[model samples]
Target: MRIRLQRDIDRLKKQVVSLATLVEERFRLAIRAVECRDADLARKVIIGDAEIDQKEVDIEEECLKILALHQPVADHLRYIISVLKLNNDLERIGDLAVNIAQKAEVVASKLELPIPFDYVTMSQRAGEMLEESLNSLVNLDLHLAYRVCAQDDEVDFMKSAMQLQFAEEIRKAKEEHIEPLIHLFLISRHLERIADHATNIAEDVIYMITGEIHRHKGFEYHHSEE
Candidate 1:
């Protein structure tokens, strides 16, 4: 029974990793669409969301089956529960990527205007957080998980600064630029939310490893410059 349960758990981990890879690729494409203002790329991301949704559902079903069949306990149980939570976070990140893609479509249609926000940098940081969170989960690296949680605040600061930049731009914007400006603001917002989801994943990793809850408390682990 133990060996079978471990085998099933290993299989579930692989499935979750596959989903993570898909979601991360979609997010990167969404960021590219934002940078290039490519509606074609944005459309691809939007269309790809259905596959992600289906995969998320499939993973949830597998997790349920594992729980019912094996009745995982202790650390094994924690790992399963953490995967379930992080799985949902990953799906939400995919949705946010689609949101960014949809906003990119709107921003693409308009005349190019000066964007005061450093949106590309913010997107890159958010992407890194997502990558690190997934790495933590895949490798069970406690430090990587904690590092991801620490970086969330940086993304949050950029998002707040973006709002200020948008508000200032709004004052001087001509009528035609208003719509694109709004979309840019929303894209930044989505990126910040993506960072939030990434943080949630990191927290789940910590819980899975330590068997201790660390939501809203990961900052305590941010010691050292490593």
Candidate 2:
């Protein structure tokens, strides 16, 4: 019975890692599609989204099976619950990537807008956060999870800058350019949301490691107050 429980645990971890890999690949592809305005690659991302969705469903089933078979208690129970929540977050992040790809397709169909701002830095940072958060989950590292939470501010700042630049472009440019501008804005929003999901996953990792919930309270409580 113990060996069987160990196998289930190992299987659950492998499934989560696989889901993370797919999500990371989609994120990279989405960014490339945006940068190169490659509708074909963007279409590929949209089509591939279903696979990620299926993986989430499979992970949930595995979690349920383990719950019923092993009836995990205490830390094991917490770990399964965390995995369920993280699985949802991972799937949502994949959807955000799909949204970015949709924006890419929209931009590809139109005349290329003038070079105003590059999303390369923003994309890179968000992608790094996603990767690190997943790594933290696999390693069960609370410190790295906290680092993921801290990096969210940088992603938010980049998103704000992109929004401002796009707003200025709208003021100065012709009406026809508005379509591409909207698409670019959507892309930024999707990237921002991806970072948000990564933050959620990091918080879940912390909970899994420490058995404490910190979602609504925020990190400020960790240091304060009188």
Best-matching candidate per lDDT = 1
Instruction: Kindly report which residue pairs in candidate 1 clash with one another.
Output: none
Estimate, for each residue in 114-216, the C-alpha lDDT of model 1 and write its tens digit: 5568987998899999999999999999999989988877887888888898999999999989888999998899998898899889999999999889975
My TM-score estimates for the predictions, one after another, are: 0.95, 0.93
Q: Per-residue alpha-carbon lDDT of model 2 for 6-35, expressed as tens digits? A: 889998999999999999999999999988
Q: Model 1 Cα displacement at 153 (Å)?
A: 1.1
Q: All models: lDDT?
A: 0.90, 0.88
The residue-level lDDT of candidate 2 at 75 comes to: 85
lDDT of 1: 0.90
Give the Å error, residue 220, model 2. 8.4
